[model samples]
Target: MSPPMIIAGIVVWFTAGSLLSWHARKNLGEGMIEYFLADRKVGGFISAMTYSATTYSAFMMVGLVGLTYSSGIGSLGFEMTYLAATVILMVIFAPRYWAAGRIFRLVTPSELLARRYRSPMAGAVSAVLCLVMLVPYASVQLMGIGYLLEVLSGGAIPFTVGMLIAAGVSFVFSWWAGLRSVALTDALQAVVMLVASLLLLGFITLALFPGGLPEALGSRQDLLKVSWTFPMFLGLTLPWAFFAVTNPQVVQRLYIPSSVKNLRKMILGFSAFGFVYTVLCVVFGLAAAVKIPGLEKADNAMAMLLSSVPSPLALVVSLSITAAAVSTMNSIILTLSSMFGRDVVRTFLPDISERTELGICRLLIPVITVVCFFFARMQLGLIAVLSSMASGGLLMQLPTILGAFFWKKATAAGAVSSMIAGGLAVSFMYVQGLKPLGHWPPVWGILVSGTVFIAVSLATRPPIDTEDFFSSLEGYIRDSFGS
Candidate 1:
């Protein structure tokens, strides 16, 4: 690991990304839809790649690997459960989102909710919650690349500098062509990420095991067994299981594919990509547990393994991890900027011109990136907890999202109350280190929020247009998907 290698990696990554961004810009139009949603004309391959890249962040290599290394088979189970749940959720929700987007020309998930709930206030509140919960989650991506660069460069490139590089790259591509650029580069990065993971696994297997993957994994049989309690597993899996709806970035992706056919491809392709990546990460984690034992911090397992590898391969793997972070960060920034422009700004300024809205969103890209970069520089240990808190915090939105699609009785007050109460409950519990009744924060948050949502909705009047909205939506979905 050397400064030159780190510099070279960054150079290569940015150069490739710039070329893709240039290509993306060639067909890009000057409109909010063009920039943010690729004019809803992206094909299947790019759509799937972008979805996969955005969904599986640096968390896969760094966080999931560490979790698997420390916890064993439970990590696999947890992640697989998330993947399965996501596919099922997508099967049900993707068509609905696509139909709504097409029918209303909606630009953001908040817009969909607002239109359904008949409340600008609902959309605004959801946008604000996304900003609050997702900024820290986005910063975690920056922090991850920063930490990896520092470790791989042997501290020649400081963590702050790495954060700057990540933030700068994210801002440039996101600002250049928006989702078009982001998705194209994400497709490239996703390929690189998968290839890099496979290469690393091969090298590690040959170097450490010498026999085969089975031998290596079998030697650590005990480490491969389930070690997590049911409560612990449930707590962690709950947020991720609902990630397709809870996380705004990925949820917004539901609106990007060109058609129902492309949307179907996106789901299936992402499912395949997720399956391979998860297996690579889990195997790597088990390998690390066997080969690089006794790490004080589980987070260091990937770094340690990389340090043990030959310099060149380690550099490649490091760049792959950096790619993961950049792809995710750029997507998050673009999605958040869209939320701000469409959900927040338009709520207050309903008559704003499309040009002004797009301009505001483009300007906010760098602003949001810089905010996340500064948060990364703080280097808070609680950052990891905040990452988990984001998923749990977002889980509070599930009832509202589901109710919007299915339950006609769900009121604006219920949506707002559930999100606010659930977000507060989850955040407070995480901060105070409280787990009510010995359950995880997410479990408590979901229970309390769901209860509040139901009670508040039953006690109050539903939206005036609830029936019309559902009836129209159902008709649109049926016509669009022919189901």
Candidate 2:
């Protein structure tokens, strides 16, 4: 794609997104709940689309496609496992989260922990941990767009410019109308991403196999097999399997559906969208392996495949990838801003007015975007490595999050101690290049944290209101979802 053509594509995408964001602002109301959760009024389709967009990101097309291209069917198994596990986790936790959010007026996931554990420190700790892990992950979205633009424009568009554009778009949507704008734009982006992927796959298929779609992917036979060893598969899938609860951005989403029926629709719709997108990404990778052989870096597989495509079609696909990045980034920024305002800021300034809280959140959106923009500009490491570390680091939170909903014995001390221990272990392993017994860092983090959480909770007294909390939560869930 030529420089002007790439620029035009970006212009069109940004304009469409801006218009959607402007339209969504009409639904926005006053206060933090309205700003952060779309006033808890998002419909099923938009909820599902936002959730899918927030959860998947450019990782699906760029990172996952690269993984599939390099590692074969293992990538498919890894992602499908995540999808299946997410559905199960959501089924168990979404109703509880929604009930809690409504009953408690919770704006952030961390706030739920704080309230359940009766400790503001728990919310603050979780918020800090989320920021530490997710900022790098958010940076990867910017980096993905940077790389995509550079590749598609033949370096006529520099990486920094791409990062700036992505950050700018995300900031505009997230700052304009908060979650309302972000969710609406996400729905549009999700459609573009899915349609573009389908179109790209069709073109690649027609170009490569003029006769018909092949029963067997030609060449790279080894690439078609499950190459990930048992430990590798477990290590990779463990953290991702629990992503719904572990990642605050998606977890916060559990609180956004307007009704029980909408929540059900959100889960089912995301499941279908995820299944199709995952399959398309895997197929695209396999096709790339066959059509563009001998790529030194597997991460370049998508770029190489795009090079073979017609310029206009390639631009469309590239814009789709950009949309994926922007959709995810905006959601992350919105969620993080909410956490900063509700969980962190309000902890110290509990008396702050709702207007001030809303202002703080709006201000933090651009600040977070700028931080991610700089990180993307630095190009610290492989996008996949940083992204994986973020997921692995977040896995530490699963024990506390799940225990908050189900276990009466779960204590604040337990949650805090376990998170610190698990986070340190994951960080040390990542920093020192340690993977004991061929297990991933996330595996170790989960094991250590689960043990620590149980031991500490057992050693400590349960919160005084634990019984009441559980009883009320259970009653609400039963009343709301009839489960």
Candidate 3:
């Protein structure tokens, strides 16, 4: 595609997203309720799309492509294992979390923690970590969009300018409609990304390799199989499985379901879509390896392959990548705003009116946008870098959440210990990776954190407040014996 055409296509897509966002904002209220949970009125299809879009972002296209380029077919095993984690989460936690969120009118994941654990400090800590961690992840998405624009526009758009544009669009939508705008835009982005991936795959396969995808696969037999050991699988999937339950952004999706039944529908639909989408991307990655050899970086693999392809296809793929970036960034902005506005601000200043808090949320979007733009300029690795920081913290939350729903022994002290220990471990590993330390951070963090959580819960006497905490989750089991 011509540079002008590619730029024009991107502009058109952003315009459409902005229009949808405006409509969502106009229809939804402007208070914290609208800003955070879309007033808890999201339906099944929209919720499913939003969840999928947020979960699979530029990371899928840019980051995973990079992984494939570096690891060959071995990366697909990691991806499949990652998808399996999502499956486990949906089957085990989504319905219960959705039901409990609705029943209690929970606005944020921290609020659930606060209520369940009967500890405001626990809520504050969780919310703060969520906001802090999410900012970088959000910035990474913004960075991805900037890079895509820079590539597709053929130097017409600088990375910084692309970051500005993407960040501005996300801020406007998130500022205006909040969660409602994000969900609606996410649904649109999901369709565009999935279709674009399929189209690009078809075009690349037919035009470049006439031997068929099977032939391409046959040549890289070793690359097509799962080469990692069970230990490696556990390392990757164990923490990732907790993402749906523990990721504040993901947990926020559960809060907006129109009803518990709708959430169930959304989970089922999203699981199927996630499975198919992940497989397609991995297939695209493998095909790209065969077609475009000797790629420099894993992050640039897909982009390089797309650019090497026919122009029109490249333009379409670039637009889809941009959409993915924006969708995830928008959610992050909304989530960050929620964390700061509701969790931090309100925690410190309980007297602040809800209306004022909403205003602060609107203001925080631009602040986060600028911060993220700075990081985008740093040109860091997108997926792997960000995931390593979060995988441990999210995994910690998984035990407490799952235990709350099913296990009777989970204590607030245990939950808090687990979070602190797990978060520190993840951060420690991240720091080590940055330094000249040895190989990949052993999956010991997960094992160590889980052990600490169970031991702490069992060893420490339940605080006087523990009773209230147990009382909070009663609604989750109410359905079994008639509330």
- Candidate 2 lDDT over residue span 300-346, tens digit each: 88888888888888888888888998888989899999999888999
Q: What TM-score do all the candidates reach, one by one? A: 0.98, 0.98, 0.91
**Clashes per candidate, residues 3 or more apart or on different chains:** 0, 0, 3
CA lDDT of every candidate: 0.90, 0.89, 0.75
Give the clashing residue pairs of candidate 1, or none.
Answer: none
User: Worst lDDT window (10 residues) for model 1?
Assistant: 211-220
Tens-place lDDT digits, model 3, residues 1-483: 466787688778878888998889678866777678888888999999999888888878877777765666666777777777777777666666666676667677887777676666667878877866777778777877877787777788888888888888888767767888889889998999889888887786778778888887787776666676666566665666567777887888877877766777788878877887777777777877787777666677787787678887777788788888888888877887777777778878989888998888888888887887787677767544764666555666666666566555666787788777877777777765632223234365656667887898897654465555445546564663244
Best candidate per lDDT, number? 1
Query: CA shift at 23, candidate 2, in angstroms?
Result: 1.1
Q: Which 10 residues in a row give candidate 2 its minimum summed lDDT?
A: 211-220
